[model samples]
Target: MNLENTLAFAKRQDEADELRDFRNQFLFPKHEDQNFIYLCGNSLGLQPKVTKEVMSHQLDNWANYAVEGWFDGNEPWMFYHKELKKLIAPIVGALPVEVCPMNTLTVNLHLLMVSFYQPKGKRFKIIMEGGAFPSDQYAIESQVKFHGYEPDQAIIEVFPRKGEDVLRTEDIIIKIKENKDEIALVLFGGINYYTGQWYDMEAITKAGHEIGAIVGWDLAHAAGNVPVKLHDWGVDFACWCSYKYQNSGPGGISGIFVHEKHFSNQDLNRFAGWWGYQENKRFKMEKGFIPESGADGWQVSCTQVMPMALYHASLQIFNQVGSFEKLRNKSIALTNYLEFTINEVNKSLGTNQYTIITPQDPASRGAQLSIIASQNGKQIFDGLMENHILGDWREPNVIRLSPVPLYNSFEDVFLTGQALLAITKKILKSS
Candidate 1:
């Protein structure tokens, strides 16, 4: 993979990509009458071409059928998630019954925590990666507080060694072991949203289980961006949002994964709503709450048809493309190409001007590369935006560029590199 600055090389890579046609499936944003080189799929994925049609179908159903749309519409609004389960199951590597699409990400996290995070007298601490997404931090803190525990005493945060941006597997295992007796749950993001580091979920799950702790994940950045084997990983549970990389539109509905091992366990308490009741008798409005079996039992409300339609539209593309293996294969090559080009830019800058804080190993990262823009972070980011290269900035010094496999091309990466180089020169000159 000799990725270079040559336009011919980028064209060759695009020509060779089996998934190259997928780039056209998205609605790319434009600036100054030209489409921007969108490399921020890890933040919010590009809109799928089918999304509009799907949304229209739902809107038409609403207009024509009114409240009866829940049952009489072409795709019943009541069971919209059932239509989506088959599509999403393969992406996360789970059984259809083990997965359910519902709520937003943070809401799902809080719900899962309510069921999984049972803090008792001695074993009450919750363990998580330090500097987790603020939503996750708030969810955990609120869960701990709800349990009548102080967050400082009940939440234990594991951090990398001083001055490090990523956590080592060995260090994580050791931390879990040290707190084995007190930890009630081990909740972590499948991939660090900021660092783009894919944690070893299987190993972490095993460690947490050995300590008698429930293990769960927030796969907001990992769901459609990487290969996941949630069931085989023996994870107790997991949740993810569909907006990022999944291309389900902004604030899209989220999903939850519950291992079948817990399916028959009647004692598992959930904050149930009418939607979580047995489907056959749901409209009966029975006196006692009889929760549905399996992961669907976790549902707290009726489906949001609009978000579900958009999610189904995107998942239909995933289905046609076969597996995440296909997407992930292209993702690794695409990200590696971007990394190689960025490195070349660093060399040309003559002082290691750009340093990628993301893991060098393909196995440890998704498509995102977090570049630390040392001297002129904001200036370089703003300049790249001016060139119609849409990436995201995480305050202070880091800029994240994610070349989504579904919609981004190799040429986009090449152009982004060019934009960075130009931005660097402009910023350096100004400084």
Candidate 2:
């Protein structure tokens, strides 16, 4: 997979791409006089052309049917979430019954914890990656406190070795084994947000289960960026937001997956709402909760119709593409090209100006390459933005660029490299 640093080579690769047409379906933001090279799909995705139309249709139903919309219309409000389940099931690799489009990511995390994070006797500890997304850190800490345990005593965070940027699989497994006795749950992000490391979920699941711990994932970065097999991996439960790689609008609907093994477990508790009641008897207004079977049982409220509609429009694109395998193949190549181009920049400069923190192995990471800028990183990031080379910058000088398979072209990656090289040169010359 040799890569060239020329725009012509990138255009040639784009010309040969079968998924090239997908870029047209998304609406890109304009910068100066042309479309900005958007590589921030790791943060927020571009809107689909169909999203507006689908949203209008739902709005029209609301205008015409009002409360009756719940039971009437083409896609009845009552069962709309079910339609999303069918489209999303394959994307996350789960049976339709095991998945549901529901509450936002953190809310679902808390709700699922009530059922899965049962601590008893000496087993009250939770193991997670050190430096997990702040939301997860907050959620885990709050859950520990709510259960009457101190955060410092109840949580174990596994970190990379002092000099390494990514966690080794052996280190993570060893930590789980060492804390096997006191662990009540092992919750981790499927992909670490800052480093872009995709953990070995199957191995983690097995290790946690050996210790009699429930394992779950916060897959905000992993869901559509990389291929996941939650059902096959026997993951206890998982949740994800659709706004990132899934291309749903900002604050889009989130999804949850609960393994079928937990469906019949009567001891598992849930904070229920009317929508989560058994569908047939829901209108009966019966007392005592009879949760709708499967993951839907965890729902605490009715669907957020507008957001779900936006998400559905994006899922349609995924459906048209057929499978995540094709998207994943292109993702690997695109990220690889970006990595190669960045390395070439460093070599040409005769110094390591950019250090990629993301794992080099395609299997160990997704589309994102988190690069640590060696000098004037913030100024370089500003230059990229001014040039409409849209990548995100984190504090302390890391720039994350993700070339999405569905909407981003190889040319996008090519131009991004050019911007980085140019910006770095200007910064060094002035210094």
Candidate 3:
């Protein structure tokens, strides 16, 4: 479909969208008494309307029952996260045992790495994508240092060939093969935060396994924005935070996946804690740590019920919408329409400054498009914000706009494009 010259077409698509009504389910932040055009789901999603209700219920339970709320209530705090697995499983395409809602994203990453990144002798280096999120980079560097190995020696980063902004699947496979001997683990983001590039998780897993390296993924940008198949992909492990595309509010609890293959491995050593103990005998105050089976074995502490409640409420909406298949279908159409509109506006302005750094191929990205305004990047970004279009600016020049499927509409995309066109003209004239 030709996206340019297509406002009518966009309206038609929105009218027919099965998920269209979901836009009203979110709480939009306002500016100048207008609902802001929120296109920042890649950074932080708009809060779901149900968040307050869910959070309040948990709060009231806490207020009335105190310590008894842990086991006495209808939705007891002790097992609050249990309801989340089925809702979350389909989003990541993993079995219930393979995933759990707990901790923050980077924390879970460190824990998963501790178990999977068992670097020994020469086969201990980790292969990751270059320019990953700063938090992820720090986690990997610290993990390497903690292992008594220098970061440079234990971490191997694969970058795109010069001039290209995104990595190719073929290059990643080649890198996996080249470092087969030294690489102990292959961990990278499912969708890159900066470039908005979605990596081939299944292919990456296959390549890593071929070299006898365990494969893990940081899916912070991918989990709700795209489809994943951690179980079918044979990924060794994965972790994700729910705050972004999942719309679980800031610092919402994260999740982890441990492949079923690891469940029976008694020899796998982990830093043990009381919460990881078998549920039936957990309160026995046993002298030895007999860990629970499956992903629960990785639990390091008591579950955070408040964050889990918020996450659970958001996840329930995903369940109601069915699968990522349905949500991702809308994502492609919405983002493509936005790209088309932006390009059309760019042509009218006679400037090529706003180039989309995200790949054009739908398979290579999610809803987010990293637009690099070559001239006056920050100025244009500030202009967009002042006009109440809430896309975020990253460092030097890129403004990341994500048309989130669940709570964003076609009109939102159209309005933002128009706002951007006006903003660009004003910025250029003033500059």
Candidate 4:
């Protein structure tokens, strides 16, 4: 995969791409009547063209059926989530019974902790990646406090070795083993949000199980961006949001996966709600809480139809694509081209103006590359924005760019490289 920095080379690659037509399925933002080169799907994915139509159908159901929409509509609101589970199962590599579309990401994390993070005897500590998304850190800290454990003592974070930007798998496994006796749960983000490093989930799951700990993942960044076999990997539980790489709208529905092995464990605790009661007897208003079988038992309330409709629209596109393997293949090549172009900019300038901190190996990362600009990072980011090249900027220095396989093209990556090179030259001349 020798990548050239010329636009002609990029155009040639685009002409050869089998998935090139997917770009037309999304609506890109415009600047002065021209489409911007959008490379920020790692944050919020572009909306599908069919999203509005799907949402409108749901809205009409609300208008026509009103209270009876739950059972009367073509796709009954009562069983809407069931359909979603079928669509989502293949993406995360779980059985339909093992997955449930419900609640927000952090809320599901908390609910799962109720069942999986029961600390007893000497096993009271929770191990997680350092620099996790702040919500997860807060959730773990609060959950530890609720169980009468001090945050500093009960939470152990495995950090990268000094001078490195990503966590090493060996370091992670060693940490899990070293604290085996005290660990109650091993929770981690499927991919580090800032560094875009995809952790080896299978290895982490096996290591945690060996230590007698419940293992789970916050797959906010990993769920749609990379491949995961949650059930086969023996993960105890996992959760993800649909907004990012999944291409659901902002603040879209989140989903959860609970291994079938946990279904019959009556000893496990859950904060029960009526929605989680056995569906056939739910309306009977029975006495004791009889949990529904499988992951559906975790549901706390009725579905949010509008958001689910938007999510369903995106899931249709995912179903059309048929496999995450195909999307992942394109993702690797797209990201590799971006990385190569950035290096070409550095070479031409005869200075290392941008340093990519993401793992160089394709297997260790997804589509994102976190770039630390040598100087005036924010100013350079602003320049990119002004040039209609949309990417996201992190604090202090890094600029995160993700070329989403579903929509972004090779030409978009080439335009980004050209813009970056021009901006760097302008900055150098002024300085």
What tens-digit string does per-residue lDDT give for candidate 1 at 118-147?
887799999999989999999999999988
Candidate 4 segments whose C-alpha is farther than 4 A from its true place: none
Better of 3 and 4 by TM-score: 4
lDDT of 3 by residue, 1-431 (tens): 65644567668878999999988889999977898889999988888889999999999999999999989989887777678887888899999988888889999998888788888889989999999999999999999999899998889999999999999999999999998999999999999999999999889999999999999999999998898989998999999999999988898899999999999888776878888889889988989888888888899899899898888878878988976788989999899988988898889798786799899999999999999887898988888888888998898778899999998888888888888888888888888
Runs in model 2 deviating more than 4 A are none
Q: What C-alpha lDDT values do all the predictions have? A: 0.90, 0.94, 0.89, 0.94
Q: What is the Cα-based lDDT of residue 312 in candidate 1?
A: 92
Question: Which regions of candidate 3 deviate over 4 angstroms?
Answer: 4-7
TM-score computed on alpha carbons, candidate 2: 0.99
Number of the top candidate by lDDT? Answer: 4
**How many residue pairs in model 1 have overlapping backbones?**
0
RMSD of model 3 against the true structure = 1.1
Summarize candidate 4's per-residue lDDT along 84-139 as a digit string, tens digits.
99999999999999999888899999999999999998899999999999999999
- Relative to the unseen true structure, what is the C-alpha lDDT of residue 6 in candidate 2, on a scale of 0 to 100? 96
Judge candidate 1 against the unseen true structure and give its global Cα lDDT, from 0 to 1. 0.90
Candidate 3 minimal-lDDT segment of 10 residues? 1-10
- How close is each model in CA RMSD to the real structure? 1.0, 0.7, 1.1, 0.7
The per-residue C-alpha lDDT of model 1 at residue 137 equals 97
Q: Which tens-of-lDDT digit does each residue in 191-257 have in candidate 2?
A: 9999999999999999999989999999999999999999999999999999999988888889999
Q: What is the lDDT of candidate 2?
A: 0.94
